[model samples]
Target: MKIENIRPGDIEAESFRIIGELLGDRKLDPRYEHIIKRCIHTSADFDYADSLYFSEGAEERIARGIREGAVIVTDTKMAQAGINKTRIGKYGGQVLCYIGDSDVAEEAKSRGLTRSYVSMEKASRLGRPVIFAIGNAPTALMAICDLAEAGQLDPVAVIGVPVGFVNVEASKERLIRSGIPCIVARGRKGGSNIAACIVNAIQYSL
Candidate 1:
């Protein structure tokens, strides 16, 4: 098979064009089109078109929060690294991943908890608007839900898409019912890349 010669700058645009063609006649909510397309682009999986779920007004809330300089916290460094820090910075926003922080590690170890869980606890104390983009750990989603239930946290929005077999769907379900603005990938299909792409798609749409 011969590779098609294409200009570097046109590759992404071309890819989206193809995705649109393949999805012909499938109407997408205008608010979520870019996010769904970005998810498919990142993973080359069309399943995202059907699996992604958005709570009412989630996009608007997230956009407003970002404009207000909400801190974006991710479960994994890979997710954090994939986010467009420069673009978010233009709005005075920043991306952070605390899973690898030394203090988080120590606390998790002492408490016999996953570092991802500890990270959410740490984030809850920020005292400012926050957006959680959790893609690799269901426990992180659980921790956030727990915090919310206890009246200790009120995040601007949550992107819950952790991929796994154990407790993944349940955690996402909990987040969905928590009454927080969120974007979730139903079932057991998601990743750090998907999480970051979703965040980037939101930023791009703004």
Candidate 2:
């Protein structure tokens, strides 16, 4: 049966199975696996989309793309995080820089991205036509979308990928309330491994 067709508990089991197939013994530890199992099983509702996480610097690459010309809205952490991949010239898409802190913003500036923003206000001024909000900073992203709707910012598509167990629903619900298309993986499947896997799929699909 399809993943969506199953109950929440069943879906968690299926997630374990799929993750097991893809990741194998790396995540097979009983305790961590049990945590994942419990989280997915108890959370009654969720939306499944390709998700991604970054322990190293995948968020940096994503941020760089935004800075250059990509119309994407991300959390402070993802925006500030730097990209550190061996394959540099592979992602030649778009760049629209939106960041949270001074350090990441400074780094983006060094990369010739002077149009970086530290707040949702900056994101508004940038006027990106499409905004993809990734990771768990929902309230901030919602504020950005609200501004867009209020004519204070350029209107665009708002998507949220809130990784982690914290405020996952509230963040996603904000996106939903804004009448934007938000894609999120179910439950606590918002860690580095799942996040990386989700991004990998997006890369391949794109």
Candidate 3:
């Protein structure tokens, strides 16, 4: 086995170069190139280049919202912890995960609903521009759709990439049809890490 000696700082650049080579002749929109590349870098899976879906003008909307200090809500604490808080804070934005909140848990238990659902409901009342980053629960996506339908919440953008078999595809489909700005992974192949990477990619592009 031969190990190529590459500098630590240049490893990521080299990896991206290889990825670009592997994707030769495949044209990706210049606007979303960073996001697609970042996802592939995180998972070592080129499938993201094909699976990721972006709503029309979603990137511009999300970038503007972030610049204006939108609050980011995630379905899982892992996603919340993975985001780059320092960069978000520079834009006066903050990341929140309500799945672990005691009130959210209690409400979900009392209503026979998942904690993710209750968390979305709770986030809706924040009275500020919000960006949802859901990576672990389809129920969370459903709740957001419901809230939007009811005219109770208007999220700036949604990142729907929950990884699961149970209603995962259905939830993403619902989000796509909701007429909301969104970025989605169109199958059961996402995670908190991927969700965070997406956010980081957007931030890095800014």
Off by over 4 Å in 2: 1-69, 77-118, 153-156, 163-167, 186-200
Q: Evaluate model 2: give its TM-score.
A: 0.46
lDDT (Cα) of model 2 = 0.44
Predictions in order: lDDT: 0.94, 0.44, 0.93
Q: Which 10 residues in a row give candidate 3 its minimum summed lDDT?
A: 59-68
Candidate number that wins on TM-score, 1 or 2 = 1
lDDT of 1 by residue, 21-80 (tens): 999999888879999999999999999999999999998888888877899999999999
Please provide, for model 3 over 78-182, each residue's C-alpha lDDT reduced to its tens digit, 9 standing for 90 to 100.
999989988789999999998889999899999999999999999999999999999999999999999999999999999999999999999999999999999
| lDDT by residue (tens digit), candidate 2, 29-64 | 242233233223333222231221122333344444
Worst 10 residues of 2 by lDDT: 45-54
- Per-residue error for 188 in candidate 2, Å, reads 5.8
Ranking of candidates on TM-score, top first: 1, 3, 2
Better of 2 and 3 by lDDT: 3
* Cα distance off (Å), candidate 2, residue 114: 22
The predicted structure with the larger TM-score, 2 or 3, is 3
* lDDT score at residue 163, model 1, on the 0-100 scale: 99
**TM-score against native, each model:** 0.98, 0.46, 0.97
**Which model is ahead, 1 or 3, in terms of TM-score?**
1
- Segments of candidate 1 deviating more than 4 angstroms: none
